[model samples]
Target: MAKSNKKTKKADEDMSKKKAEESKVKVEAEISNDTADTEENSAKTSEVSVESLKSEIDQLNDKFLRLNAEYQNYRKRVEKEKNDIFKYGSEKLFVEMLPIMDNFERALSASEQENIESKVLDGIKMIKKSLDELFDRNGVKKIEAMGMPFDPIKHHAVMTVESEDENNDHVIEVFQDGYALNDKVIRPSMVKVSH
Candidate 1:
């Protein structure tokens, strides 16, 4: 009976030791699982942060592109406005000079009067030449309308003359001179076309 009691005690101790070891192993496994879950959560958070940063970058890039496009359009508009200002800035000045030009034309036509003296004619011719030189220096040019091909952009037909030639659909005469400023026609030539 004593031997049997000793054997049962040994068996109980062994079973207790086995149960303790199993409990330790279970605790360790739970800790490992918790660590793994924490690592997975950390990875997911990092991925979310990366996606957020990418979205912000995309938004910034879009804003940059929009601003760039707006700046480009603004530059173009400013350039076009500057060009228009330069082109039309002298319109009023040129308009005011028209009367002087008309007077010059009258003086030239009256120089053919019967009572005009030679010295007076020479003086008138010098004045007219000086006026023409001034006009040329100020970017003013006279349109060539007589004996040239008819161009609606530069010539206005006031009358039509009958002609037998087919090539007569052209300018035959200019009644009043036309002027241009820097290669741009300010006024079309008043012309008679042959037809």
Candidate 2:
């Protein structure tokens, strides 16, 4: 009976040892699985952070380029405006001097029949020539209205005359010659149109 009891006790001890070995294997497997999961999660998080940073950098670069372009455009626009102001600043003064120039031309033309001395006539002619040269140099040109088709854009009709001719609707006479500066009309020609 004692031997049987000892044998049973030894069998029980062996079974317990096998159970402990199986439990240890299961615990090790769980630890390994947990470590792999942790490593995968850490890698995913790192990749996301890197992508987010790259996107932010790209957006900032785009903004910087746009701002630089805007600044360049603004600088160009200001420079162009400044040049224009400097070039055309005397436009109003030139326009105001046109009537005086026309009066001088009329006075010289009327004095052609006077019994003036030859020297005085020559001096007047020289002055008229100088005035004309000055006007030419300053880009001042006369608007030719005589015998040309009347255009409201360049001529102002102050009176109308009756005529049977087809071309009569155009300018019959120019009362006051117009002037232009640099191809732009400074004053419209005062004229008479025929109907």
Candidate 3:
């Protein structure tokens, strides 16, 4: 009976140890599950933050593109305005000088036709030469239209004459001398064309 009792006590102790081990394994599994859940939640929050940051970056990139386009358009508009200013800046001054040029031309024609004194004619010629020099210095140029092809851009045809020659479409006479400023025609030459 005493040996049986000792054997029974040993069996009870073994059963308790097995139960303790099983409880420990269960607790460890619960802890692992808790850690996995926390890690998963953290990863999801990080992904959300990354996505938000990417959205912000895209907004900034779009704004930058719009601003860049606006700046380019502004620059082009300013450049065109600058070019227009340069192209027509001297037009007023040129128009003011036309009367003086016409008077000089009339005087030259009168002097040649009326047999004016040599000294007076020479003086008038000197003045005319000085005017030519001034015009040349100011980017002004004279357009030659006599005996050349008639062009509406440089020559304004006043009358047309009938001719049988191959070059009949050319300018035969220039009634008014044309002037240009920097390759832009300020006035077209009044001409007569043979057709």
Candidate 4:
């Protein structure tokens, strides 16, 4: 009977040992799973933060480039405007002097018929020639208006007259000659239009 009791006790001890080893294995497996989950979560969070930072940087870069381009375009436009202002700055003064030029031409024409002295006429001609050269050098040009079609932009109608000629609504005579500077009209021709 004593020997039989010893055998039963030994079987009970072996069973208890087997149960403890199984519990340890289960605990180890759970710990490993928990650690893996923590590492995966940390990696996912880092990836999200990195992606967010990259998106923000790209957006900022795009905005900077756009502003730089816009500012460059603005500067170019302002420079062109300034150049045009400089180029046409003298237009107003030249327009004011056109009437004096017309009077000079009239004076020369009258002198031609007045039987003026040779030396005086020569002096007037030289002055007129100098005036013409000045105009030519300054890009000032006379508008061709006489006997042509009347234009509202380049010609002002001072009088409308009846005509027997074939040209209708045309400039019959120029009362005042027009002038242009650099292809831009400084003054419109004062003219009589034929009906």
Candidate 5:
């Protein structure tokens, strides 16, 4: 009976040892699985963050390019306006002098009709010639109105005249001469349009 009891105790000890080893193996397997899951999650999170950062960078780059292009256009527009201001700076002064030029022409015409002295007329002609040269040098040009098609841009019709000889909507006579500085019209010609 004593020998049988020893054998049974040894078998029970062996079975307990086997159970402890299986428990240890199961715990180790669970720890390894948790570590793998943590690693995979971290990798996925890092990839997502990287993708989000890339998108943000792309958006910022696009905005910068747009702002740069807009600034360049604004600079070009300002430069053009500055050049125009310098080119047409004396526009107002030239416009004011137009009436004086017209009066000089009228005075000469009246003097000629009155049979003014030849020496006096010659002096007047010299003054008129100098004025014309000055205006020419400043890029001032007279707008042709009479015997031309009526242009609303260069001519202002003060009266409509009935005419069978001239074409319809044609300028018959100019009451006042128009002048231009470069491509800009300083004043439109006052004229009679034939219908």
Candidate 6:
């Protein structure tokens, strides 16, 4: 009976040990599964964060490019305006000189028609030549209207004339000469267009 009791006690201890080991294995497996799930969640969160960061970077980059282009365009526009200011700076002074040139032309024509004294005519011619040279140096140019097509930009048609020799819309006669400074017309020619 004593021997049988000892064997029974030993068997009970062995069974308890086996059950504790199985319970420990189950707990360990549950802990490992939880760790794996946590790692997966962390990876997914990291991916989302990376994607969001990339999207933000792209938006900022696009905004920067647009602003840079706008700045470049503004700079170019300012440069062009500065250049134009320099080019047309003396336009007002040149415009004021047109009437004086017209007076000189009238004087020369009257002198020629009246058969003025040679010395007086020579003096007038010299003054006119000096004025012409001054105008040439200052980028002043005459708008040729005689025998050309009537251009509203450079010519102001005061009257229409019937002509057999000239084509329609052609300048038959120029009543007043036109002048331009640096390709910009300051005064338009008064002309008669052929009908």
lDDT of every predicted structure (CA atoms): 0.85, 0.85, 0.88, 0.89, 0.92, 0.89
Best by TM-score: 5
Which candidate do you rate higher for TM-score, 1 or 6? 6
Candidate 3: RMSD over Cα atoms?
5.6
lDDT value, candidate 5, whole model: 0.92
**TM-score (C-alpha, index-matched) for candidate 1:** 0.69
For each candidate, give its TM-score against the true structure: 0.69, 0.63, 0.65, 0.69, 0.81, 0.77
lDDT of 5 by residue, 1-195 (tens): 889989898889888899999999999999999999989999999999999999999999999999999999999999999988888888989888988899889989999899887887888888889989999998899999999999999999999989898499999999999998887889999999999
| Candidate number that wins on lDDT, 5 or 6 | 5
Candidate 1's C-alpha runs over 4 A off are 1-38, 41-45, 48-52, 113-115, 118-123
Whole-structure CA lDDT of model 1: 0.85
Error of 4 at 183 (Å): 0.8
| Arranged by lDDT, best first | 5, 6, 4, 3, 1, 2
Q: Among these predicted structures, which one has the highest lDDT?
A: 5
TM-score of candidate 5 versus the correct structure, residues matched by position = 0.81
Candidate 6, overall lDDT? 0.89
Clashes of 1: 0
Q: For candidate 3, write residues 59-139 as lDDT tens digits.
A: 999999999999999999999989867876886788678668878888999887997878877888898899889888877
Model 4 lDDT, residue 113, Cα: 86
Q: Rank the candidates by TM-score, best first.
A: 5, 6, 1, 4, 3, 2
Clashes of each: 0, 0, 0, 0, 0, 0
lDDT tens readout by residue for model 4, 33-147: 9889988998999999999999999999999999999999999999998977876778888887887789788988888788777887788788888888988888889999998
TM-score of 6: 0.77
| Clashing residue pairs for model 2 | none
Worst 10 residues of 6 by lDDT: 83-92
> Which residue pairs of candidate 6 clash?
none
